[model samples]
Target: MAAFNLTPSDPSTFILNGIPGLEAAHIWISIPFSTFYVISLLGNFTILFVVSKEQTLHKPMFQLLCMLALTDIGMSSCVVPKALCIFWFRSKGITVDGCLTQLFFFNTAMTVESAILVTMAFDRYIAICDPLRYATILTNAQIAKLGLLGLIRAVLLVLPEPLLLRRLPFCPNRVIPHTYCEHMAVVKMSCGDTRVNRTYGLVTTFVVIMLDLTLIGLSYGLIIRAVLRISSKKAHRKALNTCTAHVCVMLMFYTPFLFSTLTHRYGQYIAAHVHILLANLYLLVPPMLNPIIYGVKTKELRDKVGKYTCRM
Candidate 1:
């Protein structure tokens, strides 16, 4: 799947040797990514397995975790393989169509992840703020509906990105700066006036991320209010403990996201490497840390994972 407009010169057309120190940097990229992939795979897979095999773990929070693990797998799938191939295997050039496809999935996974994180927050809010009705509020049927809705919204919300890219013309200089087909990176290559692309991209980013943040914040705010109302220090501690994983996970995603955007505009190529480093870590770190955080902090997931693993 070559770019419709650009002819491939060679596999090395986009290799990093041209950049100063990039040849040496490739080794750094490859090693860290390789290690992260292993950890992410193991952690996410264990979470998925734990949630799937144990009926006790089938609550709304774990349900969201499973959705998150699935999204993490998709997110890693979108970037890691191509990145590894580029750095380790020296397979650099990707067709424009291939780039578009990758961008779509990456964007989709990102949007889906934001929604999943929000859903998890809502789940926590319900459990903490309305303990008695938690079961009724987050029944299996309701969780399933949320899962399906998240998937649908993920794919549907980001549809405009790739569609808009398809209409834009790229007259020349089809080489993408980064290894994978990031939306902004791909847009920057367009020969056409990219005001529309920039508008859509920035708007899309703000809309999705801000919306997710608002909902998550609201849920957390209510949870905090409810926790404060409860006088037991032990109960307050327990409630905060449940939220720790989600809070860490949200910060992990949002901080790098905002930094990457800032780096994109102000930092240019110099920030690009940093953005790539952050993006890779964003996908790998959260997934790797998520299950560990949950298993360590949430006793039920931990015990279920241990019990299921022992059985296997």
Candidate 2:
């Protein structure tokens, strides 16, 4: 192999390690990963298509669901195909600019997804607690504004990452031990002082996760209080039932995300493959499961999906 003439200022390319200590198993790992990707594509696209065609489903809640589906598609698409290529073809080289682009889109999808979850929680809260005003508050115009704001917020939050990265001097060792261009993973390859990069990354994570979780929790707290005031047990069950899918989806997204984040930052004692696997799962599992959670818990969507499948 010829010597790699890499410059700290403008490194030509970085190699992605599919999974450290598991190179022999990359093909095996891609099996499940590819399965998840396919399921995510089918499930989320089905949600988008069904919701779009069904007139009765034209509402704030379903509109938000479509947004979530878009993000799910984006999140999985951002990483999975590239990962599959690495596993199957041993094609791991990624240019610095390409890596930065991937990092931006991946993080933007993640942040926007968080925002959408918070919006979904609020939607449930309003529908249950203030049914009369739900339509007024979450109007079509309002929903459009919310979606625009979410995209704007996501862009602003992630835009700094690529900019910060460009200024850094990367080390000669340009291999990242993961499937995709995760923000921190790319940052670690830099030989320059990375305090700003790390600090900003943590700040973005805190803003997206902690702030969103607090809002979701508050929405549910009010929802519970409102539900309790309903004297009938049947009414209580009915009110809570609507939120079950959202809650399940929330858990599916955050649990793995928190675990992966903490493990990456603090779990040095853990095995490398374990960290890589969880990181991949953090991106894969939620998208694959979100539509299924909604389909099983939501009667209208389920019926529509069944009818649509029968026609095809």
Candidate 3:
């Protein structure tokens, strides 16, 4: 066992972690991940292309969908490329600076995705529950404003994570257990007191997930009530149908997220890896499903995407 000194007087050193003696590292993981990455990229790109080419999709709902696609593209690109490199080349080494950069962008993109989903829910709520005010309430200007706010929130939330991590004194172990640089993963490697970082992380998690979940619940609750108030059975069914896809996406996106956070904190090593897997699902599943979900569920989007593709 080796001990690392963490003092200004001594030179800094880092310890890398890996299996003690593995003859051949496995390469199989990259196959599925790479396939998923390609599909994710093509899927998200198609959504962006469809939305951009169709002038009719220039509404608030589609605008938010476009933003969601962008966020998913960024999230997958940030993690999967590096992960594939590691798995294919058997090169797990990463510079401290590189690690920090990875954490920053990953965090930012993930935060932005969460915010965009919430905004999308709000857009849907207004469209269904308050049809008369939908146009005025979610004007193009307002949609742009929401997008801008998502960007700003992402930037602001991540600024403190790196700043906080940079200040922590590191243990010699430089290797992260998982593939990517998660905020809590880095924080746990610190030799110094990490109470502040943990507190901040918890607070941010609550603000992002709990608050967003509460709002989503409220928005849907109102939507359900609105649906019930519609006297016509056909109209009620249609309104509920419009929300079905969104509800599915929301459950898939948030349930895994919450489970990951909770299990990662208190569960065993295997549990932690399962949580990591779930977290990846959050990034990949919603993006892959969004366009398909919206396409089948919303006739407007399906028709618009079809018309735009026909022009090509």
Best by TM-score: 2
lDDT of 1: 0.78
Q: Count steric clashes of candidate 3.
A: 0
**Model 3 C-alpha lDDT per residue in residues 231-307, reported as the tens digit of each score:** 99999888888778778877777777777776666666545445666666666676677667877887887787677
Q: Which stretches of candidate 1 lie over 4 Å from their true place?
A: 1-21, 268-270
lDDT of 2 by residue, 130-185 (tens): 89998899987788789889899999999999999999999988889999999889
Off by over 4 Å in 2: 1-10
TM-score of each: 0.91, 0.96, 0.88
**Per-candidate RMSD, Å:** 3.2, 2.3, 4.5
Q: Candidate 2's error at 243, in angstroms?
A: 0.6
- CA shift of 8, model 2, Å: 12
How would you order the candidates by TM-score, starting with the best?
Answer: 2, 1, 3
- Model 3 reaches what TM-score against the true structure? 0.88
Task: Give the Cα error of residue 129 in candidate 2, in Å.
Answer: 0.6
lDDT of each: 0.78, 0.91, 0.74
lDDT per residue for candidate 1 within 9-49, as digits (tens), equals: 44223322212236467866788788988888898898987
- If ranked by lDDT, best first, what sequence of candidates would result? 2, 1, 3
